[model samples]
Target: MTTFTALTTLDGKAPAEALGAAMEGLDPAPTGVGVFEMEDGSGLWEVGGYFDAAPDEVALALLAAAHGARPFAVSQLPEVDWVAHVKRELAPVEAGRFFVHGSHDADKLPEGRVGLLIEAAMAFGTGHHGTTLGCLRAFDRLLGAGIAPRNVADIGCGTAVLAMAAARCLPDAQIIASDIDPVAIEVAEANLAANAMAGAVTCVTAAGFEADPLARRAPFDLVFANILKGPLIDLAPAVADHTAPGGHVILSGLLTHQAEEVGAAYARCGFNPVASDEIVDWTTLVLTKSG
Candidate 1:
């Protein structure tokens, strides 16, 4: 079946989210709505909605005007199996000792490296992104340096790939992974099972460390947060508070320009910078908590 989409962009996250929320009451009513900040350093956020029928342009215009967003661009999308398309485009990714791939590329997995099977679905973090790869490499570097955390948490884990990698390295470690969206948690669970870590890593539906499971496992020896700059900055203190003294942290999902500010944020929270790896347009930072 053909689907319609209405999309617009504006400054600030509040307006974008407001526009997304407003789209829910439209005459055609969207089947899904999303608001995301663009990573092109434009400080702009995009709000989009999917619909089963044609949307009223007048309603869209009014909503855009109210939210101070750009004029809505509506278009019909041809029916395409996006999952199959994603599978076709995704090849295996190797970062340090970690290997991420779909079942079709199982033969490509290196014999001695840690293998994580991540199906090509709507979820994110297949280890192909510079941010995810940088994070994995950071972990491997730390491991190589004889630093292994017994308790680890992957905040905003898209597919739980990082958590699974840690689990593979430290069989006895207490590992937890979480995301704000339940759908992401579902994807994480499936990926965990594919990696033979079904119940090894606890998957929680949460934003940051709000879930009871995370709070109980406080003072983690390591934490992985591969989220965007805004949340990374906001999470600095909380991440520092939950991390044990002398613990390590791997942070990514940031543009190279934003790395300094994010690093400063964590530095203020007693997380001293250890090392940073820049890959393409993104940079990942590894830090250690000051005792």
Candidate 2:
């Protein structure tokens, strides 16, 4: 069946989310809705909805006007096997000791390197993105320096690839992966199973460190957060609180220019910058909490 989509862009997150929420009440209500900040540094948030059938153009127009968003662009998408398409286009990505690949490339797992199976699905962090790549490399560097964290948390984990990497390297470490989106948590669980690392890492749905599971496991020795700049900045204090003194945090999902500000935010929360790796337009930061 063909899918219909309506998309619009607005200036801020609140308005964009408001618009997405309104879309759910439409006459031909959307099956799903999404509100995401445009990654092009335009400061614009894109609100989109997917419908099994065509949505009411009039309702969409009114909602867009009400939310001060651009006029909704409605279109019908042809049915396609997105997973197969993605697998064909996405080659295995190698970052330091980690090799991220889809199931189709299972035979290509390199010799002696850690392999993480992450199929392209409704989540993020395939290691193809610069942010994910940089984070993996940063973590590898920490390992090279004799860092053996006994407790690890991956905040906003999309597919739990980072957490899985930790699990592969630190077999005895206690690891938990959390994301605000339930769908991402589901994907993370699936990926964990695909890697045959099921039950090796706990998965939870929570925003940042707000989940009880995370709070209960506090004072983590290492944390991985590859989220956007806004959320990353807001999470600094919470991350610092959950991390033990002298603990390490690997952060990414930042444009190169935004790295300085994000680093400064963590620094104010008692974190000292240890390393920064820039790849293309993205940068990954590694910081140590002050003892």
Candidate 3:
């Protein structure tokens, strides 16, 4: 196991930053990867993993592809096995009736309780982040209120956490989960299988609701979009198009400051905001389409 640190110029940081953000929700995690915005307005990324050969070789390859930098300063951390450390840090959390773990723990779903093991690899929605957790809580509330969606679509379904939760909650419901990234689709499929839900959830690689076939199959009874603000705004109409009359939508992954803009986007799509929940800097909005 080895850890490598690489620095990037201001211009070189953008690609890696995007990749890091895309991967923040992966399960089993992704090589303990992270990008830090430096105080000097530059960027640095740290990656650690197990390697049978020279660690720098792999590190250089990743940096070259992500940051487009060659010979980017590589420093090794002595006496620290970062791969093991990260796996330990990402160990599963069992709280109350929910057992949350990385993809590796997928087979270890708790007995008699609904299991949601996500393998985020390099996407978001592993339930560790506050936004994901908030969405999960919101889903729980919806279920508690006896809101069982007959058709559900998890837009931007990074790792498919929400889709799986919905499937478990509504055993007879149809689920469609999609992500723009191919890697996320793979992870989501693995997660659905790990939760013994392969038969119930459909996973695909799609950028937005308009690009997904399931969205065209039937109007969704509920839709979950946990994407960034920009895409969320742009996809609002498509979301409305896929949602049935009087159907529900769960929107998250925005700062409180951005809620108004997001809400306005949905409102324009004929979704009336029913509730908004805030936790820390993140906000989750529940909206329903007007008949």
Candidate 4:
């Protein structure tokens, strides 16, 4: 297994400066930064980047830079062998009436459960992340309520997990799943097919609701966006415009503290908060459009 080291430094350098310096020795550098408040309420930032060096060397450099402040750490990530990892991680499982697994589990699905096998490369939404699980729980709640949505859209669909969940729940429903990343769209297609849901869900690559051709169909009974706060705030209008009268929207992936800002954005877009829940430090919201 190839190992890559991640070095986190804190010498009072600005985030950009620290990131720039960290990038010097790293190859195929970090894609983004993840910032969250520590348990003690102190802000913590994790700069994720890739490196081909020894983990100890990376750790020593980052730790030495801190000079005993203990604000730096290094961790190693196994270089992902996409095919092998995907196969193992997506192994089959039976959860009540729902059979859940990844594409690699195609031949192992247990009988007597509705099987949903997906193959999500690295595009998110394999039901592993907390946010994705939260959204799935929320979707399950809606399903339990016996609400049959005529149309559904999974915005920023990622690996199209939510969209697939919806399709599983509302088999007769019209559903569209979209993402800004073309790679994500490709993954979603594979995932849908692996689950034998290719015909039930349409996957597309789009910037947001505004840029999506399906948005013109308008007024979907259910819409979901599990993305970052910035994009969520910016896409409020498009979310509102595409949701049908008396429809509902589920938003996740925002910090609990950012809920107010996100709520206000949706309010401006004509959505009223129906419910809000928090898990860990993340917030999930359910909003409804007035009839």
Each model's TM-score?
0.96, 0.96, 0.71, 0.71
lDDT value, residue 290 of candidate 1: 97
Worst 10 residues of 1 by lDDT: 115-124
lDDT over C-alpha atoms for residue 235 of model 4: 90
Name the weakest run of 10 consecutive residues (lDDT summed) in model 4. 33-42
lDDT of candidate 3 over 188-270, digit per residue (tens): 88877877878688887878865647756669989899977777888887888788999999998878888998999889889
Q: What is the C-alpha lDDT profile of model 1 across 1-291, one tens digit per residue? A: 889999999999887888899899999899999999998778999999999999999999999999999999999999999889888999889898888898888988888988888888743889889999999999999999998799999999988889999999999899999999899899888888777788999999999999999999999999999999999999998998899999999999999999999999999999899999999999999999999
Q: Rank the candidates by TM-score, best first.
A: 1, 2, 3, 4
Q: What lDDT tens digits, residue by residue, belong to model 2 across residues 231-265?
A: 99999999989999999999999999999999999
Tell me which residue pairs clash in candidate 4: 30-49, 219-244
lDDT tens digits, residue span 1-291, model 4: 555645453333355355545455443444433332232223443444444554445544553454423333556775667767666655453433455666556667666555666554543566655567667766666766777897999999988878887888787888998898898888888877776777788887888874545756577989989997777888998887788888999899878888898999999888998788777887789888877
Off by over 4 Å in 4: 1-48, 51-99, 103-113, 120-123
lDDT, candidates in the order shown? 0.92, 0.93, 0.71, 0.70
Q: 2 or 4, which is superior by lDDT?
A: 2
For every candidate in turn, the CA RMSD to the true structure comes to 1.3, 1.4, 7.1, 5.4
- RMSD (CA, Å), candidate 4 to true, equals 5.4
Evaluate model 2: give its TM-score: 0.96
